[model samples]
Target: MPNIFTQNLGETPRQALNWRLGYAILCFGLMGASRGIDEGLISGTVQQKAFISKYRLNDPLLSESERANLLGNITAMVQIGSIGGALLAFLITDKIGRLWATRQLCLIWIAGIIIFITSNGRIGQVYAGRFIAGLGIGQTAVVAPTYLAEISPRAIRGLCICAFSGSVYLGIMLSYFSSWGSALHISSHSQNQWIVPTSLHLMFAGIILLLSIGVHESPRFLASKGKKEEATATMSKIRNLPEDHPYVQTEMLDIFEQVEREKEATMGLGWIGPLKELFMTPSNRYRIMLGLMSQLLAQWSGANSITIYAPTFFAMLGTTGQSEKLFATAIFGVVKLVASLVCALFLVDMLGRKRALTYGIILQFLSMLYVAIYLAIVPEITEHFQPMGNAKRAGTAAIVAIYISGVGWALGWNSIQYLINAEIFPLRVRALGSSMVMCFHFANQYGNSKAVPSMLLETAMKPQGTFFFFAAVTLLGLIWMWFFLPETAGKSLEAMDEMFNLPWYVIGRKGAALTASAGHAENYMRDDVEKVIQHEVSHDEQVTSSEK
Candidate 1:
């Protein structure tokens, strides 16, 4: 039902804005879907007995510890691919362009999907497929936010990126439901359950490839490439206005000015310039640290563990059967999807970045602590054991706590990191800097995914201890956020340098960096408008004198 172009010719500007948003969503939608497919694979893989059997995980020939190590490797390999993909995106995004890089990666994802569904229980094929698919995911992670930020109006930038983040949840929910349906209807011993889930990845990749066609390149990128007229034309088309329209002209000048400033700051270092620039100044250094720390906090807060290993987590909570655990995981996905929508729609811009994260971390800490304490008191459910009534009630409560913790993550950490990271750097270094931050995220994600399963199953902390570890990390994250991250809501991309350069306390205060930047931009725009008006008036006077 979605129209690719704006309907109703001669429509109001508001309708035009709607059309622009529709186009953005269409272009960015695949980024989220790819993420969902990437992260969602772990959920079904951990649950698929056929996948386990394919590798002889259940064979009496292997020791339990060996099987654990093998499963860990399988689950963690995707992160390895992600890390590789991040590096590749960094090298290519600036050189070739965001749209081109994204388009090529989507093709790779389709190829990976083909390999994945046809692997037919071959470990080598599956691992290769996972790594290739991860490359696509990594590229999307680094490019989507940067691309979205450049094209969006400042007033709605956060909202649009939040929607992009929400699509990841949508993909995750779709994955869960697909796997749940497959598991219910497909034979447990058949490979179809896992294959059906993977096929969905192919569907998403195809959509992304199709939607990517003819999407305009970032105007900032075009300007950086020294194609000023092209950049202006692209901006005009994207804004649905003439090149000289005050709004379009104002934005074009802002982009051009920022690009010049960034060139001077980096001394025109080109590809390697961003790395040096990142640490050359104290503010830039701090921003890099902020980006890295934010990602680390997002990972260590333990939401990902709950996401990738939900079925296993529910089993720890004493769910009676495989079906029950899968269904519970599906419910968790639903909660996460709803929470993501709330964040994208109501919180990110309205509550401001700092407060939303602080509140979300507090909620996360409480919920994690509740789950840990409740689990510590309740007995773990053994395969043949029947739990008492109160124990069953307590177990159900623990599951609810998991869902609440997921909500906390969605509200604060989920999309905010991407939005913040995307907003912090100038265009010259935006892609490289975002890739650097994404590398940290993917690296931590790899480590976490690899370690959490073993930590849950074999550690001194057991399942309860894992949550306790995450709660402590959440407390640390809260402290980091309060002192470091400033409010970026409603600020122009060109204003970020001013925003970050201000003292920590002054950064978010009312009518400080944010206000000054807006006022400064207005001054330039006002001058341009006045100049045009004067020129028109003078021309009319000359014509009147000539007629006389």
Candidate 2:
């Protein structure tokens, strides 16, 4: 696999990249499918004629603004619920551990989907079900990445983490095709059109839960809880090595040392310790700020809005009918999925996080600028305006621009937003910090998802203005990332502290360079482990002589 992906395997042990580790990552990575399916499913589900008729979403009597508000409310409810879910995820992940957390969230997700499918014609039930589902779906953002980072080897950490990100597009693609297939074969009047596709939520959640049963809890999490022997055993099993193997010993020592340091730093602080460390410590405060800003910039960049409302956006771009719009959206999903896979398999580990982000954001900015300019120049397609000659060519270009934006998004913000938060913090506050980050993630997502419907209206930002806003945000994000986002590729979880120890202004720009020159913790730990092993061997021999 490493040969195929062309990942620089670095100095990582061959045993650490074994099948057990891969299976665990696969189980957790699929959690991203929960959010992906929801985002893709809802957009097409709402566009169904039966759904519109049953829910009266397109009622003739409702004003355009009112109808837009309703659509926004319906689409954004899960994100609203996700805010609360993310806020509480740290508590759940901390209390029960990652494996149990996966189980619980899956159950919650399944229950929510059941309620949603049985809603009949009740819009309130639809909202309630989706919001409930969001509770479970939201936790995936925090849990999967944290687990993946904690369990993975440093050399391929980016690849492992991006696996989760990539699965998001996999889910989106499957949901898009399911919706398109249902629209083609199922009767428009039948509720089965949307319900059948909605069942995908249940399928993915169930699969994740089942697969997780065989996976081990994160060894770092175990170490944090003072379960040293168990942590060593788990680490050995995951890495496919003996407990005394140099790789296993060095990695465990790193975890133990970090745990001890954190224990001292927050000894008397009790439950507030992690929170205090997160907010009061200068480095952690900076980390939290980065986490928040990543989400803020990513959500507002307009790529996510394009994803959630692909059909609507296609219609505005002059795709003529529902079938054509759905087909275009499905193709859009395909583009995103392929791009995300490329990021996961090649770009992330090979290019490094900062460079990957830089390149991706550049692509996003160019694409969004093209779309915004085209929309500004062309007559409004939603007003029954049809293009010909040069106008038609420009519209075609705009459609291509939208697809390029998805590619850029999958490569950049979509991967980093989850990866950065998961890897940046110390293990002590990893869950808490990730939870806080995802809380803001969902909050900003809710704002973007809800506002986009109205933002596309003539009375508000309009299609052109809204895209212009996205293009501007994308440009700002590119600048922010260049100056602030450090390269985190091939760095161990324990090595992150030294990476951020520089002055805030210089850290993002120069931190990676400093960390590289300073020597990695893994190298230091390996030297230390050899000395400890020799000392223990000598002591055992001395004891043997005394007994003889």
Candidate 3:
């Protein structure tokens, strides 16, 4: 049995989300998961499959090579469009609350589907649709994880954030299943056959649109915008507290306190101010680097590369069933989701920040190294590089092995990276930092979207080579973790600020880490930081009320 609350959840007692919110989370999680086809590869693969089949593509005349080129080009087009959408996320988030941002994303998804379908499988038009669909995925990629994290309470925050990642796998698995279902050999008469996946994708867009309306506005968003009252009310509903509950009061106060601090500090950055402040300070600069670097590790770790091209990767293994293999990927996604959920419970707050990061990095590093060796050592096993004979059997064994290794990493970084980032910054700067990190996450994710295809299309651009690159990056990530990242658990956002202010040499020295030394100054912004923190802390109000 799981205890929902641990560590008493702040002095002001954290608000609990009700069953309605629970249903909302489930619906949205499912909605977001459907976009995996949009993001990971369902739509891309289906479009190509339909294109190839309709043309009855075969050798040089029918040209599998031509189809490959077409697929690569169309996929790359979506990726290019995604970069623009991600950059736009920083701006959209402020205007549209996460819920509405996702709605906007669903609309983009719907547009992509309509365009793709209306083109009637025309190659040129499908590219247009992909670009449009990519826009939604890019936007959702930044917004959904963020919104889920913001609405969720601190206690189960990791689970909520990871659910977004789970959704990614969920979306992709469904895509694979959809694609496998559409295995009819290509013919010009059936050029629109790709519509199966695209149409299903349209369904995802519509359902998520409806689901988006159900969740409360993010408490963080409400707090950030100075909607203290509405923010408090939203917090109350989600946390299952009464309208005037002490928990609601504390959260309201914490939001105001953050507001109060921002007022005292010059809003030098302005609209572009947050962006400027983000890069201006060394403490934040390092965090941005660390966050991006960690995400780079996750992306380059071959985890995502494997996903975008699962059928192709499986073909390399001499494995007979692309459908089975895709399902296996789904299993990996589920396992990662479950593992993250478990880790969120015991290790999130307990393992300390540095420990969780290092552990995740270690697992990701090891998994990438293993995958590199397995693929390179047995490239000859299958036609597509899948295992053959007993070698095939062993390679099949290795696929699961490699996947589990990646899962080990998810237990650490997948959700924790977002959780860690949320805690790493002081409230004043958290959103900027988080969004920038989201930018990096999606940037590399797009890189993954492109790179995996390049590898699949050419043996010279081997998957093993990609894994090797990941292995090298893993080494860099470890050094960064050792040198720069600090333990952040059990400490409030105020203390986290102090931790970030120290020189590299002084960062991990327990005595020095906690106590500011002479000449090297540390400012906790003690008054403002505390005041801001307490505004959202309903439990803290109860304590004061009781003391009075």
Candidate 4:
């Protein structure tokens, strides 16, 4: 049977999708679980009776504002560390290479988790540990997608890159189950209640570190460093093709040509060349705007806040009791996981990036709108007031709407936020560009996560207002994307320049069409590869005869 993934392979060699490449993508993709596990586990962990009692979070003397601030600080600390981590990642990845960077970050993640679980009664230690871990966890956002995009075949690039996004929900789902199980199986008075679920951080980090040992460095990074022979060998191994194979040769040529072009564009600029190119060039500046805005819009859409505080949101929506709220949150994680898988397997490649985003955003908007209206009509529901008849039914639908919003998030912003930054920039500054974008990604996320507790307060936005705010942001994002986001599916990394070359005003709407019309050469045909091979063979023969 033909592989469903290969439907878009066009004329590309089948060997490009080998087990070695799969293993590598899998290894890097697991990096996403680091962030997911934290988001899922922390909400339930903090709510654990033992944790709250030990930390004095439930002290009767504590005001609502103080409690909100404390919760925000605890949950948002990792994002703060991630901002620094994202900034540090470019330097680390560029200097030590992608594989080593992964290993180092994994170590940082494990160390932070160790400190966190052993915090005992000290809240400061909890903060310090998560902050330290954020340094490593944050870098994964920059590193994993960058590595996946660089190595993947153009046909399956979306599928490969979405592996990272998909694993996020996988981590969330597993962590949710872990948290739920601990809550049920362990006594609430025992420290092990939260400690056992937190151990998952160590397990994921250690597994990724071990797996990194077997994966090779990115060929694009090797080519950029002027190690052409090593790059070719690495590419050959990843593609499961011989060094002399025309497919491998063509790929190497694309990488080399892009490197040479970037060199010419940044000549005499020294070590700061990539920075200068990123900021000074019109096209790059526009690309940066797109990357920044994508993160901004995605983060404020309130989907992530919901993920981080799933139990809180469920409680607010009328799900009572610790066990009941946690069960609802676990199901929320499952919904997100399934949605992410659907996006990875079918939507991203089949529907194209723009359309997938459009559909996802619409789902998000409708869900948010329904929830907002429900909250507006039944503001007393959150105060433990029971509703009768139709109002109760509407309350249940609001819960369903929250779940639908999770689906929308997985389909839309969650997938695009990571995938777009990875593919949008030139190879010369791919790491730098992705790092900078993710710094903002985490920064905005920190703001959203840190503010949501307060935002949900009666003095602030309140429940109806918060959901309304999210709905408004979702609508704005849909409009911004319609005007600015171009179709990137099936396009080669090197060919992105052509797509971005279209005028800024029309680029989002017409760039892909224009580029396709002009026929940007990706050189996927067998005949094209054969010609390149014959030319190289003839040149080699001439050199041999001349030496004689």
> Model 1 over residues 1-548: C-alpha lDDT tens digits?
32312221112233236565568656875587777765766687667777777767677877756666777777777788888888889899988988898888888778877887788778788789888888878888888888888887665677778767888888888888788888899888888877888788888888878888858888888998889899999878887888877667667767877887788887857656788887787777767888999999999889888888888888888876777878888888899999988887677776778878877888889989988897788777788775778878877888888999988888888878889988888887788789989989999998988888678765446888999999999999988777677777666788777767766565545423455535233444335466544644675687699899
| lDDT for each residue of candidate 4 in 82-135, tens digit (9 for 90 to 100) | 999999898888888999899999999999999998999899999999999999
**Candidate 1: lDDT of 241?**
82
Predictions: Cα RMSD each: 5.5, 3.2, 6.0, 2.5
Write the residue-wise lDDT of candidate 2 on 295-320 in tens digits. Answer: 99999999888888999999888997
lDDT minimum window of 10 residues, candidate 2: 517-526
For model 3, how does the per-residue alpha-carbon lDDT over 1-548 read when each residue is reduced to its tens digit? 32544452444233364685576567556644644666455433533544556433333563545655655566566665565666666678767777777788788878876887677536678778878877776676567666665566543555555566566556765665555555444332464446666577777778878866767787778777778778877777787888675445544544555555665563665676666657887877867876777777766666666666655665555555545555555565556556655665566555655677678777777777766777788755444454448776667676665666556565666655556655666555665677667667767776676656556545545667777776787667678667656665444343455666777566644523464321110111122334434533655676599899
Q: List the residue pairs that clash in candidate 1.
A: none
lDDT score for candidate 4 against the true structure: 0.90
TM-score, model 4 to reference: 0.96
Q: Cα deviation of 493 in candidate 3 (Å)?
A: 5.7
- RMSD in angstroms, candidate 2? 3.2
Q: How big is the positional error of residue 166 in model 2, measured in Å on the Cα after superposition?
A: 0.4
* Runs in model 1 lying further than 4 Å from the true structure: 1-16, 268-270, 504-548
Rank all candidate structures by their TM-score, best first, as comma-separated numbers.
Answer: 4, 2, 1, 3
Candidate 2 regions exceeding 4 Å error are 382-384, 517-521, 524-548
Roughly what TM-score does model 1 have, to 2 decimal places?
Answer: 0.90
The lDDT of each candidate is 0.78, 0.88, 0.61, 0.90
Higher-scoring candidate on lDDT, 2 or 3: 2
